[model samples]
Target: MSSTHHVTTESKPVRLLLIAVAAFILSLFLLLPLIAVFAEALRRGWELFLASLKEEEAWSAVKLTLMAAGLSVPLNTLFGLSAAWLVTKFRFRGRAFLLSLIDLPFAVSPVIAGMVWVLLFGAHGWFGPWLAEHDIRIIFALPGIVIATVFVTFPFVARELIPLMESQGADQEEAAVTLGAGGWRIFRSVTLPSIKWGLMYGVLLCNARAMGEFGAVSVVSGHIRGETNTLPLHIEVLYNEYQFSAAFACATILALLALVTLGIKSLVEHLSGHTSNSRH
Candidate 1:
């Protein structure tokens, strides 16, 4: 017979000191920087902050950023849902390899991912001539931005769903099918309700990454003011040109987005927990 022993710190003073150290590090590294971004943004006054966001280049960047997120989020959500369902509901050869492929974005550098597309679509690349012949511009355009965002955010939804679905298993889905429900019907009636919270959590994270992605989008985007610049790229441009207030002003938007994402994510987790407990 064997027993497990749990080791824990019992000294109150040591525990208190550890907690204090952690709090200090959190404040110094995370909280303070966020505070500075907002303070610096609003330092020149609210009017200036509003004006900075209202600038032509700034507004354009906002639009492009929204466009990229709007396009990429849905595409990735669909792919994630399909991939997660396929992986979790069936046993197949090369299953592990397929999962590794899905996780490729996380392993690859964002810059390298962007460059891979460039190599495939840029002038003198294999498809470049074909694209040019068709008068379609991909690299250095909206298409490239959307594609890069999709790649970087590829794993969020599927990663969120795979383990949850695996743990939940396919018993309910099989039962629904036994009752003569079709694929879409079963998915909507049974599977969706089971995984909706996880789906939403994944989507929120995907949208945040889509909006905030910098390195990949930067490589694909030409940084053309009022054209290809996303919010992060625009912020960099402003800072490089010595426009500190405008840069921080733009940063506040992204920071606010991150805050909102975090709030929603927390709420989702709480609601999911409450529902789970109620079910049990």
Candidate 2:
């Protein structure tokens, strides 16, 4: 018989000490910046903080940010669901290639992504003449912002879903089909419940990125105040104008969004774990 030795309590204390040191360092880097954002935001007292958000331009940025995220998230959710379903439920040629292509957004530079759209829509661009002739405008417009947001946040849901659903296998889906279940029926009754957590997680990340997308949206937005400016670009304008209080106030909203995302993520994780336990 092989013998196993227990780990010593002496080494346990050392491990705990090392963990404490790492935690301290991590908190300094991550937590400190978060704290700084809040501190700077509130430096001018509550009155200015409230006033900053009340500005018409600030309101416009908030609306645009929400609009972009609202549009982008749903489209990505559908795309992710479809991509995941196909990749996981069927064996097809070029499957790996398709999956790789899905991840291209992550590999590409945001600036380049925005520029690509520009080259397709700019005044002298490929489709520019035709679009202009047809009295259509896309470049330097809300549509351009929406498309750029969609491009940048595209992979979030699919990346989350593909692995989760793949591990689930096609067994249940095949069984559903064997029992004469339709495509929509199988997806609704079976696949939806299984992948809900991962889907939510993906949507969360997608929304976060959609709201905070700077580089790509910047190139397309044209920085029009109370018009094309999203929250991040608005923040940039505030900082440029030496409106530190206003800039920090906008930053604070995003910081709150980040916190909300974290809270929802934790709840989903807890619920997902509870579900697995119940099934077991």
Candidate 3:
């Protein structure tokens, strides 16, 4: 006879000790830092905190960060969907190579990615003369920031969807096509419905990374205040300038964004799980 062990029957003291250790680690590494950010932010009072956020430089950083995420997320989403569909739905030469290429960003350091762009677009770069002659500024500008964010966040959506799409196979899509459905119709009615959850999850992750990207953006941004500065970069500048309250205040915004992202992620996972259970 085969026997199974129940994990719940483990020693109570051991379980309690493990739980305590996990909780302590989480609080030390995550909760403590989050609490510290807000505490320092509000140390000088609400007025100072509000004033820090209201500063023109801070507002500019916020806008730039939003703009970068807005541009990068959509572009990456489109690329992700296309790449996933192509890889999962069709067989072709160099398919393995293509998959590796999709994962290139993850393998590359963000700082190196940013520097590559600079070497290609900066004043003394490969296209420098051409860009200079055309008065097209990319390096140390909004475009550069967006480009860096895009590179840093490139793999998120595609990575999220590839395994999902592969598991789903192309059966439903083929059936739709055999039923005389057009390309867009097949995608909308069959493919999209199947992959919607993964798609949304990927988009959320991509947005979070785009907004929070620092190493890549910093290398390309040149850190010009009110121009190339992003929220993370702004926080670094504040801290470097010894503006502790302002720095912490700016950090609180990022912390809040991280919390909101986590909340939405949990909600998405919960909803997806509930739906899955119902279907089963």
Query: In the order shown, what is each candidate's alpha-carbon RMSD?
Result: 3.2, 2.9, 2.4
| Candidates sorted by lDDT, best first | 1, 3, 2
TM-score of 2: 0.95
Which model scores highest in lDDT? 1
lDDT score, residue 250, model 1? 98
The candidate that wins on TM-score is 3
Candidate 1 clash pair list: none
* Cα lDDT tens digits for candidate 3, 25-67: 9999989988999999999999999999999999999999999
Q: What C-alpha lDDT do the candidate models reach, one value each? A: 0.95, 0.92, 0.93
Query: What is candidate 1's lDDT per residue for 84-196, written digit by digit as tens?
Result: 99999999999999999999999999999899889999988889999999999999999999999999999999999999999999999999988999999999999999999
Name the candidate, 2 or 3, with the larger TM-score value. Answer: 3
- Tens digits of per-residue lDDT for model 2 on 191-218? 9998998999899988888999999999
Residue 174, candidate 3: alpha-carbon lDDT: 90
Q: TM-scores across all candidates?
A: 0.95, 0.95, 0.96
